[model samples]
Target chain A: MMIKLETKSLREAYGLCLVELGKRNKNVVVLEADLGKSTRTVLFKEAFPDRFFEMGIAEQNMASTAAGFALAGKIPFYNSFAVFASGRAFDQIRNSICIPKLKVRICGSSCGLSDFGDGKTHQSVEDVAILRAIPNMTILSPADAVETVMMMEAMLDVDGPVYIRINRNDLPIVTPENEPYKIGKIWELRKGKDIAVFATGYMVKKALEAAEELSREGIEVRVLNVSTIKPLDTKAVISHSKGVKGIVTVEEHSVIGGLGSAIAEALRKEAHPPIEFIGIQDKFGTSAKNYEELLEAYGLTSKAIADAVRGMAGR
Target chain B: MEAEKVKELKKVALKLRSNVLEMVGVGKAGHLGGSSSLAEITAVLYFHKMRLNPKDPKDPKRDRFLLSKGHAVLIQYAALVELGYFPREELKKVKTLEGLLQGHPDMKTPGIEAVTGSLGQGLSIANGMALALRLEKNPARVYVIMGDGELSEGQLWEAAMASANFKVDNLVGIVDYNRIQATGPIKEVFDTGDIPAKWKSFGWHVIEIDGHDIPQIAKALDEAETVKGKPTVIIAHTVKGKGFSFAENSAAYHNAALTEELYKQAQEELRKQGELL
Candidate 1:
């Protein structure tokens, strides 16, 4: 089977989806912390001027204000860089939003070392781990642009707090456009019998590519898209690992308390194969000229994943 | 303000003080200083100024009051008990695992609009509610009370800038200017100089009044409602423990366990105040 090579920007898709959500629901409001242009929420600001709140550079205030909006029967989507959204305003999100369980959607754009030029200060490789520790928080990591739009639509129907991690660059469209996205469900992008590869966000595309590479070497590899990082689909994880030689977990984040840790915790009690984690190995990202350079430096490429699978297959 | 209404509100404030003592009990630690300081303001807002329904706490068109200085929640709980938001018996069970009330403001409580206790976040929540009400064309208003010492948090200034920038006229902020914190006085700790001047420069309609005076609190609230194009901040000058003889102006009583003698003495002071009224 041949895979399409088309690509689209997740940030641009998020902006367009906010405009559509605003039109569908009058109570849909957007809050930005002076990163509207970078996060693409300026599109929503242009469309619904009355509903858009420019909160300056104050992420803590923006978070609590979103809680207030939710209290008054409005669906608010607050945007900022992943580091500022999850790290700088963690307390506000914990006490004001998650503790009370308000209907506030937090969008952390340029997540997981995607903002390559800004270095460690702007990049967020631990957002999922930090947010997952808090109760009543639903974490969403869309595989591509199509899934970003679908997740935003699904967030409106969710009752409690949600944090959606979006990448900076245009990613290959991996998910189907017509299928409705569910909150705690995993999608199998490719199937095999020898090894199972669990991936999320930008890594899903890399996982698919790696599976195709392994297919040529007579080694079958299965690829699963674990989009919902929190409240993970453990049953699917366990069942997919069945009859496989080993499992490989991939993400654009740290190996600690992320998709890898989530899977490891899930299978600790159940009967499963050995697992290998592929991510930032507890190290800060450095300033790079481009995204591919950073991915290569961090060993987050199709070749690296294929090598891991081949090692698991004992080749 | 009518003299009869003033008398009635004063009685409500006195009752709130009595309720605070009951909630604190004789041995357990509670925020007596801040709770006592907010009694009159809480009474005036819940009984006279804000539009609310105890039976239907989630009414879409009702006014909102958030305790940004949530350690003073005993006074709000006292007012809520009187208004029948919860049972009066629950006052004795505050800060207990089986009770509806917690040490901080939680949404689990029937009348709490936001979960607060970590200081300096309530004003922003009030601003959000104000913005939402304006967009929906709802005539309801939002009120938040902050501690003077809570001004030490940088997030409070961030929220102040946001409320002004958004022109949230439907929101009103009150600072319990007791000038004392957990450790010591505001001047010795973190002094926010010239309170009214600070808020006025931030684009809020500034109002200063004696927090214990019922008529003054009522008049300031009425004045805040008429202001447009900006939010209002009423800096209510107050003593830390206004009603009690031993606890007045004392930071030691801020969150101390009352002795059996002090408990009886607090009740006696309230009784004498009631007789004078």
Candidate 2:
């Protein structure tokens, strides 16, 4: 009854996770805010109809309901868009889940311009910042389908409330099939010296590309993929950026309170290094015809990282 | 409920009331009126009703209690202290920095079930806890105390609907119908007339009683235990600042602090009622 991580699409990965959760744990429940199909938790409803709760578009109620389910000894994985999950249910997430430290995993897809065509109203670049502000909240922005599956499994092991931001777009598989995904640890994709490229969520892929582009210019860039945003791997971030002359942080989220800010805070405490942040600069993203255009508009591209790294390197 | 037990419970309730006022007086901060109104209900649940193991607050089989009207957490803290969850001396720690006692109920504290202060969210947490208990086939009841004014939150009804739909018989919701909210009378702010009827319409077994009546409150809870299907809602009519004269029925005390003179007046009033243990 092992449901392999069958789907590469983020939506499909969600469905697979729910189906696996239903088979293994009877206490595992799914809560949807009338966006079952969109969030891909409809798969759980199909499998364990009795355990699934359809809270009907009220994101706040859905969040607290998940907390209720957790109090009842059921592992509840809630699903909604990032905006609805974080914004519409900010108080609920803070008070009911984070403050109480409930074992609830909030699976918010379409984060950080994943809704390319949906524009500013749908894109949720602020979720990471908002969730990070709350104490005892674990935030994860998985890179691709593989990472999503890994985090979905990792969530069962981690105790307390977790916010797993999954991008709507399907990312190219980066981790080898056998590579174990550990929570609160960074993945050193490529080793280099002069500049360290710290990236998170979907930006990890762009970071790899940026590193390759910089390597051609003899500016050896080290790529570190940080999926776990909270309970951050401060040890790895500081160690990696230790001797590096310049550090470049990249994220699909706002420069405020996302990966860049987190890395800066850690760096500020340990050692001050010349750090250049390549992310959405304290502004909302516009609706573009496609995801690539949205990234370009926000300057969250490999070229942007490359330019930032080169600038910090004084090239 | 026997008269002696009823009298004992009333005494505990009054002590809890005094503790809440004392904490506010110490911290020089708190929701005085809301806490006073909720003291009796908190007393009935923590001291005499709910099955909680103070030694193991996270006991799986234990009944659950959530304070949805979390701003009045001073009342809950008072009950927790009197129930021996923590030392009675902790009463002085209210609103202090680096202390477990915060202005709002926080689950991080040893005995608190959920961190509640933002209105209209506690019942959902209780409902989830109750649903989980039922799924585990355990017979532990989950009690959630909400302010009457909190009914303005649509999620309360959503939780109510879900509880009855799931037939969560082990879930009990008690609304402290103190008739006053932050601004003024609840009727003037938002009238939720015939609350008992409203709960009944939502498919719950609704019971109406005086929130300050210890015997009636205990009896109503006992009656809920016999109900085979559906959840129960006890609309307990209460007086804001029940034992304190100056704060009573006054909306300003919802989160107001007592003056030194007022604190002495409140203590004198509690002494006169013979409720001081």
Candidate 3:
């Protein structure tokens, strides 16, 4: 039942989705902090010049300015690197955006190890840990380009603040086209009873790959994409993982506060089960030749997930 | 321009100062030093310059005022109540739990264009409103009041540069350069050397004026409107805690409340200022 889908970068989908949204609603405004080329908001700026704003190298100002636009009845989407958008402007986003519950959608690009060439400063490995503590903030980490578009559309209907972390590299489009995506909902891609492989963002692809590898060895594995990191759907996570022997959470982010921590927090009061975490382990990333090398160095590949799955299932 | 009108604006300024004393004195914990510094600036706008209506605070054509230095929200609250944006009785409950007035300015209250208190963020929001209005070809102007100490935030510099680059001529920024910070003088705590030149280098039309003077404040605002193709910033030299002699230029009064005896004494001095105006 595998569908042959084209591979495209999430940033490409993010840019095109904004262009489409700009056409759909004139109230849709895009603001970029001197990263239109990398963030791909240039597509939106080229399409709708009037609605696009070039804020220039100021992430904090860009966030608060977006809040002003939101207050003036415009849906503003501001973008920058995850490290800057979520880290440097943490206070601005908390007070100016989240405290007032302004409808400013913050898209943090080059998340985790995605910006491998630029090194640790560009790669944001702990954005979820930093943002989840803020009140009235919704966090979404899309798995692929298609889901990125769907989440962008979903945020327009939402009234409060929403942060979506986008990957840098192109990934395979795994989700079925035209599939409805909602905030705080899980998408069960492959079902099995032996062990659950919970993943998010780029790691969802890694989890699916690990599931196929485990399937060849007669160890049935279940894979779930928890896109909405905040307001974790504990019910779906627990129900789908009821009879599984163990669980291994995979993410492109840090193991402390990303998908692994979310799953652990959800299963806190549940029955006996061992949970394994796979991500950047409580440390900074390094400048690498490619993202693949960084992933392998950080133990964030499909083989790492597969090994964790087998170890958790006591194989 | 008229002497009688200047007297009236001064009267509003004195009354607003008294109201800040009453509200913050009742609230027992409010920003007195910075709030006092912004009294004349807020009065010059609400009473003389800005085009607004108490009945229709959200009128699209109305000029906007944002208090970026949100800790001094009592001054703005006094002006809003004077304009009848809300009931005068609400002033008595300032900063109380579940009160209409909070420690900082919030959009929940009418006439508050944006929620601000976190310093160095208001100018950017004001610039954003200017951008939106410019796109609509609307002639509405946006005014933001920022503290001198608030300029320590890097966001303010970024916003200043962006607003000028965008040619947001309809936006005006007024700095209450009261020469003091929350702890001490701005020079001792992250001083921004020569603010007027700093703003000028950012491509803004800069003006220096006595902040407490009514006619000068009004005339500066008018002059700002005539300058085309760029935003304008008025650097007003003001004293922290102007009216009361004991609180003047005292950092201890930055957030400290006055005692009952001192409160009555300050009220007497303020009543004299009111009568003189």
Top of the candidates by lDDT:
1
TM-score each candidate.
0.98, 0.90, 0.95
Model 3 lDDT, residue B138, Cα? 81
List, residue by residue over B116-191, the lDDT tens digit for candidate 3. Answer: 9888899989988888888778898999999998988889999999998899899999999998999998898777
When sorted by DockQ, best at the front, the candidate numbers are 1, 3, 2
RMSD to the true structure for each prediction, in A, is 2.3, 3.0, 2.4
Question: In model 2, what lDDT does residue A134 have?
Answer: 94
Clashes of each: 0, 5, 1
**Predicted complexes: DockQ each:** 0.92, 0.67, 0.72
Candidate 3 error regions (>4 Å): A1-7
Q: Which CAPRI quality tier does the interface of model 1 achieve?
A: high
Q: Largest TM-score belongs to which candidate?
A: 1
Docking quality category of candidate 2 according to DockQ thresholds: medium
lDDT scores for all predictions?
0.92, 0.84, 0.88
State in Å the error of residue B268, model 3.
Answer: 0.9
A85-148: candidate 2 lDDT, tens digit per residue? 9988998998788876878989887888988998888889789898999999999988778877
Candidate 1 vs 3: which has more TM-score = 1
Best-to-worst order by lDDT is 1, 3, 2
**Fnat, one value per model:** 0.91, 0.84, 0.63
Q: Interface root mean square deviation of every model, in Å?
A: 0.5, 1.4, 0.9
The sequence of per-residue lDDT tens digits that candidate 1 reaches over residues A97-188 is: 99999999999999998999999999998899999999999999999888887787777888799999999998889998777678889999
